[model samples]
Target: MTTISNTERGAAKVMNRTDLTQRLVARLHKDEAVVGGIGHTNWDLWASGQRPQNFYMLGSMGLAAPIALGVAVAQPDRMVFALEGDGSLLMQVGALATIATVEPANLCVIVWDNEAFHITGGQKSLTATGADIVAMARGAGLTNSTWAADEAHFESLVDEALGGTTGPRLIAARIDMTKPAGTTDRDPVKIRLNFMSGIAPPDKEG
Candidate 1:
């Protein structure tokens, strides 16, 4: 497994979260399922576009990747993406090991590392003190983990992940602490039903 050094990560272009979220959403031509982590992660997803396949995590801190893993496992033909924040991902880093163990070919986890818990009062996260998420992910056996170098590089990684058949890939981006463009509607029931309906196979007439 190749290690991505801190110097390489420091060279990555710091980008705005909302812009990247929109970019990712725009690239989804298929009915790909996106599980957005709590706080601004989900807010940006909601702002990108109200896709029925987008599931927002209203209260959870670190369940986005796990939920996406379940979705990928259940629907092997569908691609799944998990958008998680640095702080939130650290809350359940174990999920990375589990995801690696399962090796869901269609699953991709994108970490927006802004170095702070922006939504929860902007407290500096461990990432600010030198915790390398991509390195940790690789250590957990996700050899495909990498830190996106810039906007174009991020897009290229996403495209590659979407096109590849071997995955359980992890992409970490150094992001700016910009506020989300909008807030997700706080209706868990509706969100759940919408996501289910969105990803469900079409009904066949007898």
Candidate 2:
């Protein structure tokens, strides 16, 4: 009956995404870590345009999962997580099937299912119940998935999901995107160029 309540009923910690991202990134600080998503931080990282340790998502919301998959496959020793949004995941739902096949233990997919595209406007999305997320991921063949209703539970889930278990895990979180962090303005052309700099084909001419 309640929509997007901070229920805090799970064992995972509820965070404002960037905070969680900072926490997780801190955990893997020493290693080659990559956080792919669509938004301000992403655009910032993309504008910086560094490779190996930096990957900014360009077009498509759901593609971050697949992108992280490739990064995990190509660089098996690195740490990769997808800071995905619920709206974006709705765009590329099928890519999840590939995730199950790849099964990169180091891969962690965190969906900040705020029920809207924060970067755009806090408009309504398909995640009216937050049901669209957890249900879809479970059905996509991914195991070790959980949803966090509060901050404490989210932290715990992160620990369990990333502790030592084999992954392809999804953490669906419902949040309120009202606390403005920043804008979603980025140099798209520059992002494309920077992105290409990192993963250019061997035979491709620049």
Candidate 3:
């Protein structure tokens, strides 16, 4: 895989988070796992569709990627996607480096960079000023990191990642600070059990 440089682009495409989430959900046919971050990220994922393969985080600043990493490592045959917000990702940026070090081939990280902690108070984040998440991921040794230029480009990246490519890819997108349309059901135990059953091998699933 090749590293995508921020300097090589004009500006990242600004897209609605829910639209992207819906597009992603529509394309999930291989039982690929999705780990949604706290707040809007997970809210939109839950809204997109309550698939058993989707894990929604309720309360956490930046555990999405870490949890997805564990799932990817544990199920090497399954593709895992982690959806995170720019602010939350900034809170635990070190996870990117750890993900790079482990290098799970089926892992894909998607960062929604609205440039603010929208859930909290709409405070500006470093990305709003000058931080480039794709660049940061690349620096952390995730060479397959790239900024989606537009919705079409984002779809292309998603297709490539889910096509069984050997990658621990990171795809960052510029999103708007709109409220998500739905809420994740608040049942942690049920979520865990359903996800476990969804990902288990056919024969292993009782």
Candidate 4:
């Protein structure tokens, strides 16, 4: 495992999810696949710009990383990203260990840790008190996991993950309690078809 710098959660800057989402979208030049978790995470992804390569999880809470893992494993040539909330991630924490075991070099999981379940009446989550996601990720055997120190640091980490040949990188960012920019189109069929077309090879696209 490569040794990347780990930022302490307390020392990390609190940022807005919408801003960070836009920043991440702006950096994707190569048709990378991004699986956005339910609610706010997918809303920001939709607002960022509707890339056909983006998959929005409508009802599922904790399947973003697992879905992205499947995409990463299937499309080894392309980069894959999973945008998940801290609460959702905790719900499927075992995915971290599964990802570590599979070791997909093209996979990168980014957790938006606002420390609350923003969509569900903003209830405080485990992260609000003492849950450390990065530490949990490390314990799950994802050695490349780390807390994003700030927005700039987050971008640099994204760049490194995109360029480097490593397995299952994890980045946790402390986010603010800001609302998402927009709501995603709720057409599950259209979302699935578009994402399928987006990730397909040119010859396979309709």
Candidate 1 segments whose C-alpha is farther than 4 A from its true place: 1-7, 203-206
Per TM-score, what order, best first?
4, 1, 3, 2
Instruction: Please give, for residues 136-199, the per-residue lDDT of candidate 1 as tens digits.
Output: 9999999888898888788878887898587789999999988999999999999999999889
Task: Output candidate 4 Cα RMSD.
Answer: 2.5
Candidate 3's error at 200, in angstroms? 1.5
User: Which 10-residue window of candidate 1 scores lowest in summed lDDT?
Assistant: 1-10
Overall lDDT per candidate, in order of appearance: 0.91, 0.64, 0.89, 0.94
TM-score of every prediction relative to native: 0.94, 0.73, 0.94, 0.96
Task: Please list the Cα RMSD from the true structure of every candidate, rounded to 1 decimal place.
Answer: 3.1, 6.0, 2.6, 2.5
Task: Please list the residue runs of candidate 3 whose C-alpha ends up more than 4 Å from where it truly belongs after superposition.
Answer: 1-10
Residue-level lDDT of model 4, residues 117-183, one tens digit each, is 9999999999999999999999999999989888889998899889949778999999999999999
Clashes of 2: 10
Model 1: lDDT of residue 75:
89
Locate the minimum summed-lDDT window of 10 residues in model 2. 1-10
For candidate 3, the per-residue lDDT at 103 reads 92
Provide the clashing-pair count of each candidate structure: 0, 10, 0, 0
- Scored by lDDT, model 2 comes in at 0.64
